[model samples]
Target: MSSQFELLTTRRFLPFFLTQALGAFNDNIFKNSLMLLMAFTAASNLPMSTDILMNLAAGLFILPFFLFSASAGELADNMEKSRIIRWVKLAEILLMSFAAIAFYYELYMVLLGLLFLMGTQSAFFGPVKYAILPSLVNEEELIGANALVEMGTFVAILLGTIGAGLLMGLEQTLFAVSCVLVGTSIAGYLSARKVPAVPMENEAKPYKWQPVRQTKQAMRICFEQRPIYLSILAISWFWFLGAGYLTQFPNFAKNSLGGDSSVVTVLLCAFTIGVAVGSMLCERLSGHKIELGIVPIGSIGLTVFGIDLYFATPANVGDQILAAGAFFEQAYAWRVLIDLSLIGIFGGFFIVPLYALLQQRAKPQERARVISANNIFNALFMVGSAFSGIVLLGVMELSIPEYFLVLAVFNAVVAVYVYSQMPEFVLRFVIWMLGHSMYRVTHEDLNNIPDEGAALIVCNHVSYVDAMLLAGACRRPIRFVMDEGIFKNPALGWLFKLAKTIPICAKAKNEETFENAFKQIKAELDDGNVVCIFPEGKLTRSGDINPFKKGVERILEETPVPVVPMAIQGLWGSFFSHHGSGIFKSGKRFWSKVKIVASEPVAATSANAEMLQDKVQQLRGEYQ
Candidate 1:
């Protein structure tokens, strides 16, 4: 009865959450444990080159997420999510058993096979893990829930990585790792079994014979939604940037800062903490929406901080050992931590929104398939990033910091390109910059209206700028019923169209215009949308709410749902409106203060335009 976030405290979320955390923990535990040991522990006896084998292991693990993820998505969709998760966790048990045997027998290929199988288990689990959230939580709590999950995942990495290091460094490493995986897998399986059944996303999608074919078909379906597809691309780019950043850390510690093991720890901890901190703050910062402002902000930070790290690198060369205390004794150590933490914060800001956005916005029928497509792209990008490392570091004569600078540029370039193609992200970016950089704007009585379902919002027709102001204030999208004259205005028409504005005209000017407008309005309202109509029918020239029109009654006549009364105060005298008309009009276009206010909703069927006018007047009592 309360809301979705309330249930997050229940056993359902915690158990599943622990299962996920433990799985991720065990994964990084085994993978990094093996990699570190292969590189340093058995350097003299290993058959393959240290770097080559380590890189190969990394590639093999990521490969299945690409090749098998689509099939995994289908399996998740067709089978029960909780049931699928159980099998995935159970598979981890067997896989880890094989891993311990491989390590004990000194069979690197067998060890590598276990890693690939672990990847497969994760691949199958990935779609169900994310896709199940929406079914479990209410829409309103999704942002906060996602934030918690994201924060949990990052924190798990922090602990998992350190745990793996400690285990691998032990004398009985294989036994220790095997024990952890077995225990964690059993716990994961138990928690997974407790999760409520979440069925397939699209029961209609054919259960084909071959996974490759299923994967391709799912990929095609995912690409159909432009915004969803954009999210996938953005996610892929994040992987590219993240992989590049994470890959360079050890090298950065060894070469740029002239430090060894402890330095690597400091760098890793700073980055992990940064992302963890940033991710937790996203729910508050984004107003519990899958805000893309953070994405652009994070990208900018990724570029700036990344370039800064290059210049700030200590003018020393080669590796030197330093204990934990000795490393932080240097002033330069804090700089690296600060740089890495900010990078992580921005990374949290960037990645979390895209993931939550993809989950929330994806078509219910094909959500898993869409997520599978996401996994496919992420795998491809990560592999590409590894190859890119070889090319940049191996072929090119660039230093580690230089490689980082190149990645920063790539982050900025790709971000700008993608955001430009999909202006919503840019729109959110602009609004975010405006509200954050400028003064604070508060909303009163915003919850007076329903979160979903049809609602008719009535507001003062302040100026051409009213829609933009309201759009920024609210999380939900609104279809503004603007005058046809304003709609055709060359300057603002495109903006309105981009916003999917509905243009209405007087019956005298063109009967067809009103006809089409009402049809669209009726359809949007029927679809349970928020439609804002200025009953004054035109911008106020008298510095007050103009006479009401019958459009309000007409809309209610068609689809009577909820009539939400709203207003924009302190903007009537601003630049966008004709404050005093003629020569008194201020031409100032930027840096203007504006405010939008909303009042409680009225009953739609009993509401009249005159009553709605009074509601607007009451809300907009004050001015700039």
Candidate 2:
């Protein structure tokens, strides 16, 4: 297990990562510089008030996501992404040049127009930014790749923002900002040139010029897959919450914390650093897989810390404004910073897996379009966040901290709804907890399980948690076949049901369940799904291999799918096993080392109960 940072050393990921990071950095630098100028110095020259101008600026920048995202997605899907990136980066260089002129001449309108164009460029880059990763890295590396990209993105945003503020304080502000903008753009273009060209996955579709129609089409494509659709919505919700918090930070610092501008920067730094740290930690936490289990953990943290932040805010407002150091000395200031940081950390945990899952599961040909739809939704959610802030803080007259409390509650509601709609998230979380907490689990030759297609996995039944441990070990989803009694256990039954486990009973006990279990197994196999069966038909009462049942043969005779022999080692005496005092009655074993070994698939024509038993026994080998 090499670190995700190693990818930065390779040409395949390094160039594109640089290009993406520099692009984000440059965008924020220009955007923030323009904002600071308007707020501090240029407000008097503008017709609208500073507040209106700032709001308008924010809207203008995000508006392009709504207007051009569909077209951008289509173009990304239709052409080689590297070529598009180069051209987009070149356009950025041109746009930034004009922006430099706008800054030099104090052409505020021109600057705003350039801002919109910058947004348009980013909108175009959004789809390819993510869609290109699958082409650059292997599936196993996708989670790491997403983590790096996310870490780079937030870090760039933070540096660029801080840089803009610093540049604004300089005597030659406009000249310095202009130079950095154009220089960063040129560097981004050069990086884009080095990115390895990726060919289109499918032939170009006929171009549609209507943004409205294309937007609907892209959204329809996104909604076509249930899991992907929910993932997009979940991601959009994150952006919504993020927008709300970011929008209020200036006021939150000034009014609530009695802090000056420097304090706002400190808060931003805490949150941004948290997200970067969390993003980097995701690869390790997920064991280099797109583990959805951590998503629930993220949501929980977001809600918990968000609410804590509300409590952390001091009720008293002093007329004296504090600088960063003074603010830190105040009561509860550290608490507020920690809350914001943890919120960002959990946000990273929430976001990375969904992005990887979307990339992994979406149709490759339409992946760009699906991502485009996600951008559109993200934009809408962000816009909605602004409105929600206006309503809550203005019309509803809620304090900033109170408003945060509302957002946290709403987050909980949204999380519950999402998990209800997609129980797989909760199920995976349970399995992930089992793997990370109760056992230090490892896998051997698990890649022998095919990436795609129907296959039958035969493993010796060691305990009630066998299926879950196996689920956490494998990358793909598996439908496990279990005896009805264990599958219907009051304690674990709901989890098994959520996993869509096929419950079976002997024909003598219940003919319908026995017959129906085979039917469901065949149906799952025919649908090109992986199915796992415990051939022993029951947990071994002793720490030894039970004789394989004939049910496996019946399954192979009907389905004829490839059979994968698997073995679970070191679980015999654990709490879930029948060994010792019986299941759940034995002494607890925390962090017990466990290994799951998988062997090459046995052909359907050659597989049988006895052969699979032998192969599994060989794989298990005395580990138990």
Candidate 3:
């Protein structure tokens, strides 16, 4: 129930948040203002067509990210970030001065150049901004921190876009932009001054200046960690999809919806607001962890809503400008707006975790380079998006709505591929669903589980889903030892396999399998991972804890790992549990409250199965 906004009150998070938001706001103001200027005022005087100019502006802005992100990443990794951020903000102020001169002189070419310069500044700032989060906030605060940052970013983008449009037609438009840009840059610089110093992991490392060499080096560093590599890919794909959506908004509004420029604002506002809402909700939904389950859910919504938007397109949109109010009058317009909003909402769900995951998992020394690699891919994806749009809409002659349909199907394919490559994503989705939908799960004394080192976790099994739920509750990865029969069940066999749940058979039923299970448990423990087992060796059939089995003693005799007793409560009557006639045949309980509580670890030398069961029993309380 704690507010993610509380982070804004803290010294570690607030300054960086303001600096990042201000930079994003300034970038959008310049970018959006130029786009507006070229389309309306400068088109007649310019040699290039408005379309070409607009696309050129966008490409120019993103080009530096491709060329310099790797170098930026290297710099961030080798030097202190607070210093880097301050310099970047100062560079922004200088660039805005040039932008002001260019705008005042009506020098379109100079303005375009300044746009790329702004992009270069952002490219250098990107890696340090993201890579600093892990050092600034504790693990428990990461999701909340990311949520606030992501939300602040979108809100800034929204405001910047709106501000650009409002100021473009004003009497001293260039003067106003000059003042605003310089003001935000100064504000951002002031914030950077307050950013707490985050030490560089590698201060002696030499910076690489060659773009190709640095990019290849960064890629090499990224590939050294599989999860980080995949997360970067997923994040890049999001940018690709986002670029497609955002770039098409103007045409979709004007041509497809037969509306004026104002309608585009309405559509964008809906999407931006939706993303803000979804980003803020992540902290609450994730229970303050880097929950990957929300990624799949977000991707699903993005694809579904994207497809629906194609269908939601009004069939008879005529060549007439509709006011914002009028645009919402049509039923399908409402549907279209809703689809856009949901897509943005799901987008937030998809993106925040990937960034958090990359930060949490990447090597400390190379984290900024990993983020730099991410930015490089993001640029590539955005460029690829432009090409894809051209091919689909130009060569194929697909309507904007039809392009949305194509992109939607492509999103589903990309998601399936990513999830297939990383089963952890899908498994987390299952756990998240079980925790959020099937039950209102709560954790108590979860911190009792050691952050690292081997621990033997013994829990009273209450349902077929208990292991999955427990995996979700505990912060560290748990190696659960489940009955072999349940492991082979067709409904959940593959899931259990993906989860790497250890399957154990009774010694009487299969001595070899049971012995092998013990060996695997010891191996996992030796690897310093948590190994969990049901002390009763099976789920309680009567909603009560069964007598503890002797297997716990045998395992302890070999490994002597710390034994942590945990209790699963309020799952006895759930569909997965042996409730009433049997399991899986009865109506399911929705949002049932389930509690998983862990007792402090007991020394393996003195702990016994019976005593651990008593601890679990007491933790279970009235539920069992």
Best by TM-score: 2
Candidate 1 residue lDDT tens string, 220-320: 98777888888899889888888887888887787787777777877888988888788778877887666777788888888899888877777775355
Over 4 Å off, model 3: 206-208, 584-591
Estimate, for each residue in 158-262, the C-alpha lDDT of model 2 and write its tens digit: 999999999988999999999999999999999999999886888976766788888998999998899999999999999999999988999999999999999
Most lDDT-accurate candidate:
2
State TM-scores per candidate. 0.89, 0.98, 0.96
Note each model's CA RMSD in angstroms: 3.6, 1.3, 1.8
**Candidate 1, residue 463: CA error in Å?**
5.2
The candidate, 1 or 2, that scores higher on lDDT is 2
Query: Model 2 lDDT vs. the true structure?
Result: 0.93
Q: Clashing residue pairs in candidate 1, if any?
A: 77-200, 570-624
Q: lDDT at 80 for candidate 2? A: 92
Runs with alpha carbons beyond 4 Å of true place in candidate 1: 1-8, 199-209, 318-324, 437-439, 444-454, 483-497, 503-523, 526-528, 541-543, 554-562, 569-605, 618-624
lDDT minimum window of 10 residues, candidate 3: 582-591
lDDT of each: 0.80, 0.93, 0.90
